[model samples]
Target chain A: MSPETTVTFHTPSTLDEAFALLKEHGDDARVIAGGTALVVMMKQSLVVVDHLVSLASIPGLVGIDVREGAVHIGALTRHRDVETSPIVREHLPFLSDVYGRVATVRIRNSATVGGGLAHADPSQDPPAALMVLDARVRLVSPRGEREVAVAEMFRDYYETVLRSDELIAEVIVPIPSATARTAYLKFLPRNEDDYATVAVAALAEVANGTVQKLRVTLIAAGPTPVRAEAVEAALEGQSPTAEAIRAAADLVADAVDPMDDFRGAPDYKRDMAVVFTRRALERVLLAQG
Target chain B: MQLNVNGRTLEAEATGLATLVDVLRYELDLTGTKEACGVGVCGACTVLLDGRMVASCITLAAQAQGAQIQTIEGLGDRELLDPLQESFITDGGFQCGICTPGQLMAAKALLEHNPQPTEDEIKHWMMGNLCRCTGYYQIIESVANAANAARGDR
Candidate 1:
């Protein structure tokens, strides 16, 4: 057991109070939602803080609603909520599929989508899916609020552009076109409780039997979730045929620079990214048909 | 902090970041919830958080505040055991009993959520809780038997 330290815990009743706590504590305080990832890091002595402001007590931050033109998920919404959300199942099954496969049921029930994205683990599934979906995150601080694209939110390995005093309030995801199809695939040594060796999420729209638009993102193969623009370029304007998908998959091997580790070698992970991208594309294409 | 453990309310002094497993063993002296892997990966410290199975080793004690927590002590007394407990004893589901509490809690939670879980559903849901004894077949059968008992089938 680590030495006992005096750490103040503040559970604000409202968002304004939560922001005030963040503003008051600054770098000495950390916002805790679903402590799934943060608690583990704390136990490992990776991060130590004198104060923790829990966002779980804040109301209106645990619901998912699709209004107007976007799907808004509160920062405190758990992964299990996303996995079983009727709205997500009806409109964004790809996100649901990714959430269903994250960690395990125990973790999913407590791990929030905001915490997962804020942790910015390169091997995490949500960031890869959000990157491909071109999601936007809303950050709140005492000063004001600002929104940033998911792709730009990540700065490097296990790092995000989130400031110490800024808290992610919600994530706004633009609804995909009715013609669009998306899928997420990951490779892990064991099917349970293991991080992804390489994960791929692809979204594409087929029009007139030709690919009108495409987006591909790879995870665990780089410092952060990366958009495979080269692969997207290869697939756009091409027919949703096996040949086109194969060519797009081939482009991913060069687009990502994977690292060699116990999970797999760099070459193997890169090959897996290609294979996973191809399979995910094929699944989405067949679903459209 | 005051928590309703099993059926009784208890007050204890604990930090916000202290794990539920630590609260049970260290503060409350309910040592049934084992701590195998302190991380959430191992379900050896599984317990019921408001009747839902969760890895207590990873769950913060502060998170359990005002919530109902059920440990192995709440399952049954030595003389009178829950049906699931009886089933495990009869079906040889445990070898060393180190992971039994977690397994039973997870199985009990599964049964509560789904009375008649398919073998595949049980396998998929229980994948997070690992048993080094590798006696999953008997454990699954025990859970099924308990489910049957709960439904008045046996």
Candidate 2:
């Protein structure tokens, strides 16, 4: 059995206070948002901490807005808010659909955009979509602030590039061009609420019978959200014929490195990744009226 | 810490790690909220925190300190059953009865959010509240019936 530990909780109304609490608690402190994932880890003793500094009380950390050709989503914005936001629905409806499929409505109500990114689970839904959308997370700390592309956020399974003192302040997603169609496909063979066995997100712009631009990303297929760059390279400049799409989608089989779990074996997930990628590609490229 | 639970302000001495479910059940004797899969996956501990449905088992009491927390106990009693409770009983929404409170709370949240939700919307909203008895069809019917009853469509 693990040793018993009494935890202290702090709800700091400002980043300065939160930073000071982090300094006071040092390595024993952990930043909490929504507490959907972190609290579960705390209960199961997967992550033990002496102090939990909450960002809920902090102002200016919640809301969504379109500015400078991008959707600026506050770190504290809940998944449900993003799913239901008219702006997100109108500007990034595919993203809204992806957020709506996360876990369930109850979980979405409490899980925040930043918290989910900070949790950095490879099986999560948003990372693949965000990567395909070319979203970037603005991170803040007592030291200063910086932005990192969503494609570079994850380090490993359940690990991120976030420093202990740094918090994700906002996620800025560039609105895709009106002509670029996007699709997100999650293979949930089990419960609807369960994580995807292998998920795929694809965005493409086709003109004059040629693929002008394309981006593809996947989840639950690797240690981090895997970008199907090879697949993108093969199709971006070519006509998205069925043969071309199938050949490009087949490249994802060699791209992902999945672990064996109840969801599927490594071999099975790789196949599903290819299958879903193909399906998503067809939705964006060929299924149009 | 002081909590605004079910429209009443109460003091609780739960530790920082004590989840809202723990405080509501152990300290305040509001045992209507259950904990099955203690990790937020199972919606057995579903509650309304500041009018939003959340898994109380994963929400820290400290996190819910100032929020208006509503548990199953607040959803009316034996003398006056909530409309959802009435619908569940009338529609046979449960078999083993383990997931009833959560089903009711989640249904209540759904009806509050969308007073006239379609069958698809109800199913989507109540997807998190799992029923091992496979009483899903009845649960869905119950929520749909409740919505109809609220809107005088029954």
Candidate 3:
């Protein structure tokens, strides 16, 4: 669209209506929740669509509630709400902090959690936190609905496994264990609002000075949020110590494959990934102690 | 599309893909809300859609259908300026002034939800509203001064 392309806009009040609209239009239709990322892409002519199916009219899809030990955040819930919600603050304060750090208050007020996740930008702050929390994204289509782990959501840079007809409906974050300690550290070498050069999210359960459980994740260090499985493998049953943490974090250097960009070179990002992972794990371990 | 802008219901014809900033600037002629960065990074296009400050440059005009839109023009009339507007003028919160409208709106949203914001809150809220001229201390002080004035400390 050199000048501008006028597309048909569809406001579907119900999920079924939205599904039908998407089904009819297929790949030609695009679903927009807050339109923060999609609108920028559309303006840049990165994503051109003939039909825009807006989910703004859909009710019962913008509330955050606690259900069966999980925080059920409607896909349309604005980031501001998530950052300020008492329910989220009480149940998942780490998630609240993560959302609060995205962009600034103005952008967060309009950007939805579902929109952010579907945008699938690895540098975004939420994915690393969600991965550590084992969050799941609820996707709906004309065919059916299914839940996919947020960690498994992104396939590559600016890509996800979501089908064209499927719309992200909600994000389900399982409440962390009472004894679990979590930390999300975003390393921003540039300005505050800029995306992280390398971010880390770590959750661990330490009992009797031993590592009972651990989950370490990183963002903007690779094509997707890299789950540092090797890091976890090194310290799963070992004692928690400065030396052990460093050794385990070193494994992150192997797991990430970040592309060279303005943020940092691929090798630089890999190195910083290890540094951030160690720091994140140290914070969580200290909290456990 | 129908929009309730500045407490007035206005009717305008806009494309489905047209952003709210363009609709406000070109169609409605509400150029007070400037558009510096078409992307959402800069808050030059910030406006309150239903009491929440949003990047209107990235917001679709159609998404704003039935929502209450408030720009800097809506915040104050020609005769009486809003407290933030007054504070901005008094404290010299802006230099070139492209970011002033967005800064005012963001500050307005902050004070609405949080009547008494700490310096950190003001900074966090207004971080998106970048200024190329001022060093940001003046903007922070302006918001703080507005908050203090609103709190009857003036």
The local distance difference test score of each candidate is 0.85, 0.90, 0.89
Among residues 3 or more apart in sequence or in different chains, the pairs in candidate 3 whose N, CA or C atoms overlap within 3 Å are none
Ordered list by lDDT, greatest first: 2, 3, 1
lDDT tens digits, residue span A83-126, model 3: 99999999999999999988888778888999899988888888
Q: Please state the error at residue A154 of candidate 2 in Å.
A: 1.3
lDDT, residue B12, model 3: 79
lDDT score for residue B127 of model 2: 88
Index of the highest-DockQ prediction? 3
Model 1 scores a C-alpha lDDT of: 0.85
**Sort by DockQ, best first: what order?**
3, 2, 1
Model 1, span B1-154: residue lDDT tens:
8878988999877886777898889999998989998888878898888776778877788888878899999989889999999999999878889989988888888988899998988888888888878558988888888889989998
Clashing pairs in 2: none
Give model 3's TM-score versus the native structure. Answer: 0.97
- iRMSD for each candidate structure, in the order shown: 1.8, 2.9, 2.2
What candidate 1 gets wrong by more than 4 Å, as runs, is: A286-289
Please give the lDDT score at residue A271 for candidate 1. 85
lDDT of 2 by residue, B1-154 (tens): 8999899999887877888888888889888889998888879999998789999888888889878988888999999988888888999998888888899999888888789998999988888998989559999999999888887887
Clashes of 2: 0
Give, for candidate 3 chain A, the lowest lDDT window spanning 10 residues.
Answer: A1-10
TM-score of each: 0.95, 0.97, 0.97
